[model samples]
Target: MAIFRKPGRSGQPKPTPEPTPGQVAEELAELVEELEEPTAGGPADGGPSRQVVEYEAEYRAERGRRRGATLVASIAKLIGAGSRSAAKGAAYGGRAMADQLMQAAPRIPVRNLATLRAQHPTAADADRLAALLITGASRASAALGAGVGAAAMLPVPPAMAVEIAAETLAVAAVEIKLIAELHEVYGVRAQGNVTQRASAYVAAWANRRGIDPTLLVKPAGLAAMALGAEVRQQVRKRLTRSTLRRLPSLIPLMVGAGIGATVNRRDTRKVGRQVRDDLRSRRPAAAAYWSAAAPALPGETAP
Candidate 1:
């Protein structure tokens, strides 16, 4: 009986043609050269293969900037405007603090679903990614106000108080990024451009809850959010709470710094986890949209 190979749809696998002596040496030399060359990712199935660049470096740089700004702002927050009316101290302080947040908000690099899925291919991985951000930001936030309170008490100028405010703003930005990215991870894309989306995120921060998608849209398609009386009241209340929470960071010396950092880290994790739980319940809808646009979430259940 003679052995034979079957012809599959693509035909029989090609039988290796024995190489000539010269061809063998050429192939061997090419193989040596290939092995010696620096290795890098080649095209896979015609798609460009690239790894997600972890943002740790950028995060560090931004944290350093925040720490410096916090020091400067600390003085301003305490002394208030030198030439302004004494009656204006409270109002001016509030306005200046708000201004810090306004500046920091846009600087937050809230990765969208595409970037997230590229970096974190699974739900579990995404969770770790969020956790990493929270932890890193918490450390930075803790560092921002460290010893500044004690520094304020010294013969130094009024800038130290504002540093506390700056630390709070920086921490808020970090948490806001975590919140917004969590929304993206869960498949919910907030309406409008970056600013509008950020406003919605700020609302979530104000409320400490996940956004209601229906409310993300408004009749005035161009308007980001009305911030009507009720919304204003809500934001005011949230800010008040935040201010109260920040009091401890003003503690001077190593003790205050330790407490401030601990509180910030704990609170941030609590907020992140709470928002994640809320989003998880409402994930399927957004997951469907994202699944169509990107990869599926690991272990995502059917809608």
Candidate 2:
């Protein structure tokens, strides 16, 4: 017992000391100081600071405005192109109809009736009377179609779709009636006689336009012709005198195409606006929720 073990060598480990309460308090104070330091460009909490949020809001608003402007401009250009096409189509259709009428007019005996009235008094009186009736009916039908087509081509709002449809139908009716009346007045009373004449007329017009004659004989073809005539007339009325005089020969076709193009454009824009509004109205609430949940301070938990 009196012989104590020799002390450990210098390589032995030393005893550890416990930390004091004062040291613990000092460490806590250092941590608090670090937490209290202001963030570089944000609030102390992790949430976006007021200034940062405001700036972001402004940026987003500006970006939205630019995008909106671009979208509107694109729509306008498309609408303009459509309007031009419709006008042109109508004009061409009218010209075709007119050409057909002019060619057919010579075949009728009325051309000689005018001269006979001053010379032979009663030369081919029955034929002259029949021809007059036929010519009158044809002219009336052509005029009616031209007027309605023109009205449809005007830049009315989309709300007038019903009116436009009515006008288009009216024009087609006039055209069909005119053909029937011409046959009746000319004493072409055979079964399917009017239909045959109509087919021949359509074929002649198609040949002039370089389209399929079969297309011109279809019901759709007649409708198209009437609509086209209307469109052409409208374009002619709208153009400046200088342009009208310069392009007198091509006016009908140009106007019809322009009207069709215009209608397409206007309708497209109307649909686009509706879609934009719907999307804007349907924005998710999640955006607002996330924007509201930002942390108030860098070291604080999100509220």
Candidate 3:
């Protein structure tokens, strides 16, 4: 057996391999290591940043403010310009209409008109009646033509113009009838005495309000006559039991005059403001002079 040992090498088995100490230590270090850096183009804190969003919101707000300011300034300028133009147009139109009415006055019969005081005979009754007629007529005419011309300035449909014209004429007719009847009940004549009295009242009121009284008188008279007729009809219904049918005759005149005073006052103020603005725009350096001197002019502060 000892002699044959060297010859048994062919039956030997292979040994199993074991890990080295250095290899084991390297693996342990890798398992316990912390991340060294973030991935490319990724956020360091791992969430979306708000810098871009905040910047965009701020930019939008600033832009909106600028646009709003521009719009407001434009609107203000347009309104100011329109106001001046409207006032000039209204003045011209009023004068033209008054002249037309005056020319026609001579042909109108005056002696048969009724008076307003026959039914409500009180202090200053005649004056009160005249006041009512003037005021009411002025309001009616002005209202009827309020924005008609303004529409023409715009690019409106053709049909709208016809409609507006027809409506205005209808309203004017009604107002004239009312004024006539009110005068009739008061025993005032439509053509002469009542017209003169009403004109005087209107002139006085216009003087106080700084407007051209002449511009308002005739139109107002026409409107009063129209409204007076309607008022008379209504009074007829209410006064059936009493002796008040005559009351309708005066109501239109009295109401008209009162309304005229109010409208004149308001419109005068509006015109003055526009005039001031126009003057300022045209001559900024002369604004102070105009303000102090204009009111002292004949018709500026007459009323």
Candidate 4:
């Protein structure tokens, strides 16, 4: 049977396409960068910058719309009024997530020692800056978790899968950035090109420690500088565990929101402390000996 065509209104703008994984990573990186720098003329209290608080509100609002739409469709499905396409779309895998993370890692910007010093001139010691970076990253991560958790009450199972992937990628990006910056703070910047250094940081993220240049396993030949296969496998395992840990945050009612935020904040702080301790142990002595010069801090200009 032939159906009649309906007339459409003119001058309506097209809706924006859903962002790809890479784009999301870039967005998160930009946000982290903004959060890193101290705001001009702001208070000296050392809390999250104005941007961080604003982003949390914006992030929650955006996620609310996405999840709300999905929840309605999900409810329809539970009532036998929707299709199974959503379940299929939610079949995202851990390997794919890891690959996306590896690709996105290099895109995240890490400031050098000179830049960090310039940006934070008041910071008298590496530990001071490290503490600020850790706090900012922790707040950002908590915001992400809370945004996803508060998205819906009794989130649909299929929708929860997608949310888990989004949260995992976002939280990972924030944590990876934290790890890289901590390396900068302690003067242990990884060697190699941008991609190579990022891969090293990703490895550190997987191991939950600072990058030890000597212990790094480089590939052979032309690809020798790239992230090795063994490390990729480790990243996959790490991401899977992280994803699983987020499962409890999908509990019915609004309880999940609090759990997600607290867990993310605590986990990020824990990682920051662990990496800091390792870097501190490997850090060179600041005092100069009579016969020799003390090594300069990472990114510090050598005398």
How do the residues 61-159 of candidate 1 rate in per-residue lDDT, one tens digit apiece?
344434433333433333342445234533434445554454445455666766655544543454655554445444444444443443444432344
> How displaced is residue 184 in candidate 1, in Å?
0.6
Whole-model Cα lDDT of every candidate shown, in order:
0.54, 0.32, 0.30, 0.67
> Model 4 off-target regions past 4 Å?
1-13, 17-23, 33-85, 215-227, 284-303
Task: Report residue 149 deviation for candidate 1 (angstroms).
Answer: 4.9
Off by over 4 Å in 1: 1-96, 99-107, 120-126, 147-157, 217-226, 286-303
lDDT of 2 by residue, 201-296 (tens): 333222222123344335565445434554345323322221222221122433643343233223223322332233233323244432233324
lDDT tens readout by residue for model 3, 65-178: 233222222222222323453444223232333332333222222222222332223314333533444433333333323223222333433333232322222222223333
In terms of TM-score, which candidate is strongest? Answer: 4
* Pairs with backbone N, CA or C atoms under 3 Å apart (clashes), candidate 4: 187-298, 219-224
- Deviating ranges (above 4 Å) for candidate 3: 1-123, 147-153, 185-303
Residue-level lDDT for 7 in candidate 2 = 47
**Candidate 4 similarity to native, TM-score:** 0.71
lDDT pick, better of 2 and 3 = 2
Please give, for residues 236-294, the per-residue lDDT of candidate 4 as tens digits. 89888888887777766767777777888899999999999898887442332111222
Instruction: Count the clashes in each prediction.
Output: 11, 43, 45, 2
